[model samples]
Target: MENCELLEKCVFFNDKMGNMPSTASVIKMRYCREDSSGCARYLVCKALGRENVPADLFPNQEDRARQLIASAR
Candidate 1:
């Protein structure tokens, strides 16, 4: 699958995951590179906007992402 369009600007990698290269790479492979639809940050960004996606939000936090989307609606 194609990489996520928001990969370059994703705070998860640029900031949160900056200190953990190995872990970040693994997550990137699973979410940013392989598939982004399941990424919580991506979900919020798509449903609302990049601004609405919390800086602390991680790719795997799908449940929280759903709640955020719901609250916004």
Candidate 2:
């Protein structure tokens, strides 16, 4: 899959698991972008995919990602 797709999937999985890594965590890991968009999530997901993490392992990843993004105040 493309990097963007992988990142999205990773964010979905992570958020679903209730372990949403903070923006600081992402920044410390150098995954966050200056752009205030979903780009950070995408980057993190792509990184996870590079490590061979399977998105299918989390059945509700997409839904969870959507919910997390929506619920973010």
Candidate 3:
């Protein structure tokens, strides 16, 4: 399988998502969604080219988004 740099750097990327590494289930990384209660990829997709990943964009990763925003500057 191809490596997904996005999932590699994403805070929501959990090794246990599918009982193994990040790609245990999905054949492709893009099809993987964070199982967290927040980012809600069902409602909104991940954002890009920002100081942070954007809380509103990755709602399932709100706390990580906040940290990313603060650490950016």
lDDT of each: 0.91, 0.39, 0.40
TM-score of each: 0.90, 0.23, 0.26
TM-score of 1: 0.90
- Which is better, 1 or 3, measured by TM-score? 1
**Where in model 3 is the C-alpha error above 4 Å?**
1-16, 20-59
| Clash totals for all candidate models | 0, 2, 4
User: Which candidate should be chosen as best, given TM-score against the real structure?
Assistant: 1
Question: Between the candidate structures 2 and 3, which one is better when assessed by TM-score?
Answer: 3
Give candidate 2 misplaced runs (Cα > 4 Å): 1-60
Candidates in descending TM-score order: 1, 3, 2
lDDT tens digits by residue: candidate 3, 1-73: 3343355544344433445554445422443343332333322223434233433343334566555545655
lDDT of 2 by residue, 1-73 (tens): 1233343435443454345557435542332223323443443244443444334333223455445445542
Residue 18 of model 2: what lDDT?
A: 46
The better candidate by lDDT, 1 or 3, is: 1
**Order the candidates by lDDT, highest first — what do you get?**
1, 3, 2
RMSD of each: 1.1, 13.6, 8.8
Weakest 10 consecutive residues, lDDT, candidate 2?
A: 28-37
